[model samples]
Target: MDYYDTIILEYHNTILDWVIADKTTPIENLSVLDKGISDHSVITLEKQKPVKRTIACRNLKGLDDRNFASDIKKEAKNIKQLDTGAMLGAFNSNLRAILDNHAHLRTRTVTHRPSAPRMNEQIKEAKQERRKAERTWRKSGLMVHRDIFKTCTFKVKKN
Candidate 1:
């Protein structure tokens, strides 16, 4: 008996690219596999380089901690007194101060790194690996055994 045999390959190349890029921006080319033969057909794939973006750092200084704390306290008092507008204004001022302080502390100069491919490359590699595994299973007659294991059941006795 003659049976039609076919193989379908699908993959996302970003994951592999991310792995190769070391989880950094501007990922680079990722070479995973070469030409290979399967039970049905051969497969070939390549990963492209990733793109980088520029991130800017804004300077924030002159934030007074004492003033921030006083504002917070005043806002709390206003809130207790049911002065909604005043409380909201004070709360906004305090929040702005805190954010400014944090920005000042965390500020850093922007740096550009070489671009590399994103996560899609890695996904494609994974899919190719899966296809290879399936082909290997078919060649080794292991798929049938795996199915048997899936349907297996064992009776247990209570002690």
Candidate 2:
């Protein structure tokens, strides 16, 4: 009798299609309540919809062994055989090259990517600037000093 019941009866087929596409089980019975207590009519639909899950992965490639081998061989030749420090340095340099190659493989080759500045160099520059600013502020009269008082308001009063 109400508008909701009329709409449900008219578009029952379309509603069924939406329910089916959403993986909701079809309702056995639909009822319209015309209880005189409430002004608005109540239409009850009984069904359960299944939950859906999605999965995604990043497209990343591993480092090419040929390039890594060539870099290691080139770096290894520069070291003198007799010196232990030179051999260790060469080994460290080769290891760095391999790590750099792997890092390149994980990142995307895009023109819009912004390069990051060296963190240690930036920190050193910031510390230098802070020291310079402090020196300048100390030379100026802006720095203030206050003496502590025994009867300060911040101290709690004893009963």
- Which one wins on TM-score? 2
For candidate 2, the TM-score is 0.24
Q: In angstroms, give how far residue 139 of model 1 lies from its true place.
A: 33
1-159, model 1: which lDDT tens digit per residue?
222222224344432211322333332332344345432223333434444455556444555667667766665565543577876776777676666654543544455554444335555565555555556656778867445433331111110
Q: Quantify all predictions' global Cα lDDT against the true fold.
A: 0.47, 0.49
| Model 2 poorest 10 in a row by lDDT | 145-154
TM-score of each: 0.23, 0.24
Q: For model 2, how does the per-residue alpha-carbon lDDT over 1-159 read when each residue is reduced to its tens digit?
A: 111222333234234211221212346456666565655445667754444444433333555667767777777776667888877977897776666655442433333322333335655655555555556555663533111122221221210
Error of 2 at 27 (Å): 47
Q: Stretches of candidate 1 above 4 Å error?
A: 1-74, 78-86, 98-104, 112-114, 118-159
